[model samples]
Target: MSKRKGEISREKILSSAEYLFAANGYHGTTVSQIVREAGLTQAAFYLYFKSKEEILDEIFLNFERQLDQFVETGQQLNQHNFSEVEKHLTQTYIGLFQLFGANKNVIKIVFNEGGQGEKLRRRIVNQIHTNMTQNQSLGILKPEINTEVFAELLVASIERIAIRYGIDEDYSPAYLGHSLAGILFQGVLTKNT
Candidate 1:
C-alpha cells in the first residue's frame, strides 16, 4: 500500500509539473508551485525527485524510452522494398502523432520552452542517425545517402510537421502520415525500382 501510494504521489507530482511547466515554462515554474499544484508536501516531492531539474530529466527520459521502443520496432519493419517502407514509415508517423497528442503538454514544454529539450532532441537525432547508419551498412537504407544529414533533416521535418498538427487537432494523422511518407520517399528511396 505504501508502495502504491508512493507511486501515486510521484505521478501526481509529474503531472502537476507537466501542467505547470507547460503553462508557465520550466524557468517560470518553481518547486513550491509544483508541490502546491500536486497537493503534496515538498518532502514528498523530494522523496521522489531530487529537484525540478530531476523531474525534467525523468520526463525527458520517459519520452526517450518511448522513442527507443519505436526505434526497436522500426528496426523489424520494412526490410524489403520502397512501397513496404513507405507503409511502415507512414504507420510509424501516425503512431508518433498519437504519442505526441497523448503527451501534448509535456511535448509543448520540452519543445517550445528552452531547457533539456534541446539536449534530448540532439540525443534522439543522434540515435536516429546511428540507426540509419546501421541500416545503410545492412543495405536496408541507401549507402550513398549521408545518414547524419538525413537523420537531422528528417527529425527537423517531422518536428516541424508535428508542431503544425499539435496546434490544431483537426489534422488527420493519416493525411499527415502520408504527406510525411511522400517527402521521405522522395528523399531516401533507393534506386531499386
Candidate 2:
C-alpha cells in the first residue's frame, strides 16, 4: 500500500479502535478485533500503533490537543462578555461531547479507567487547571477558591456528565452540555456582594 493509503488505514484503525474501546472496556478490547473492525491486517494495525493500549493513548492525546485548542480559543472569546463566556463554554462542552461521542470506549477507557490511560493525563489535568484559573481571573469562577481543587471538581463533573451521555445514545450532548453550563454560569455570575 502507498504511504497515503497506509495513513488512511491508520486513521480507520484508530476510529475503529475508539469505538471498540468505548463499547467494550479497554482490557476487553483486543488487537485482532480492532484489525477486523478496521478491515486491516494485524500488520497494518502495527504500522500505526503498537498495541491496543497505544491506541487509547493516541486517542487521549488527540483529545487533549483538540480540547486545549478549544479552551484557548474559548478563553479569548470569554474576555469581552460574560454572556459570550457562557456561549463559548456551552459550545466547547458540546464539542467535547461530540468528540467523545465517537465512542464511549474512550470515555470508559480514558476518562474513568483513563486515570492512568496516558502520559498526557498530566497535560490534561494542567490544562483544566489553567482554564479554571483563567475563568477565575475573568470573574466567572470564584477567584478566592483554590484553582487546583476547582479544576479537579470541574473535571469530575465533566467526566460524570460525559459518561452519562455516552451511555444514553438518545441523550442530546448539546442540551446536557448547555444545562451544565447553565449551572456553572449561575455559579459564576450570581453575585455574593
Candidate 3:
C-alpha cells in the first residue's frame, strides 16, 4: 500500500533530520536546515515535529524501538542451547551488527551529540546487564561473572566495532559478529601460549 502524504512528509523530515544531525552536530543543525533539507516548509516540519529537539527525540525513539525488537527476537541464549551457544551468539551479534549498520547515522548522532548519548548507552548497558543476569540464573553464564561489568564491556566493544567496521562497511556483519563471538568466548590468548 502507498504511504499517506502525511506519512511520507514525516519520513522525509526524519530522514533529513538524521542526515543533518549526523553531518553537523545536533546543536549545530537548525529546524530551518532540517526543513530545507527535507524539502518541506517549516509549517510542515512543525506539523510532524514540534521543535528541533523533538525531532531528535523522535529519531532516538525510532532507534530504541528497533533495538527493542532486535533484542526480543535475537535473544535466544539459554541453558537449553548451551551446546549451540557459539552459533546462537554469532547470529545474535550478526543481527545486532546489522541493526547498528543500518542505523549508522543515528549511532553517530547518539555518540557525538551530548549527554543524551550517555543516557542511551546507560539504558543499553542496563538491558544487557539484565539479560546477562537472567542467563546467569539459567546457568548459561558463569555465576562468578559480574553481569554489570560484562554488559558494559560488551556494549562498549560492540559500539566501537560497529563504528569502526559496520559504519564503514569494511567488514560484513557476519564477519564482525563471528569475530566478536570468537573473541568473547575463546579469548584473545592462544591455547598453546
Each candidate's lDDT (Cα)? 0.80, 0.73, 0.86
Clash count list over all predictions: 0, 4, 0
Please tell me which model should have the higher TM-score, number 1 or number 2.
1
Using alpha carbons, what is the TM-score of model 2? 0.73
TM-score preference between candidates 1 and 3, better one? 3
Judging by TM-score, tell me the better candidate of 2 and 3: 3
The sequence of per-residue lDDT tens digits that candidate 1 reaches over residues 68-173 is: 7655544664464755766777788877777777888878877876657788788878888887887777777777999899988978887887787744676876
Candidate 2 structure quality by residue, lDDT tens digits, 1-193: 4578878898899989888877776787899999999999999988778778788778877766666765465357556576566788788877777766765665666755546654455666667788778777877766688988766676677778877764566677787778778887666554755
Candidate 3, pairs of clashing residues: none
Model 1 misplaced regions, further than 4 Å = 1-3, 77-82, 113-115, 186-193
Which tens-of-lDDT digit does each residue in 17-124 have in candidate 3? 999999998999999999899999999998978788888888888888887754543245764467887787778889989988888899899878777788888988
TM-score winner: 3
TM-score of 3: 0.93
Q: Which candidate tops lDDT?
A: 3
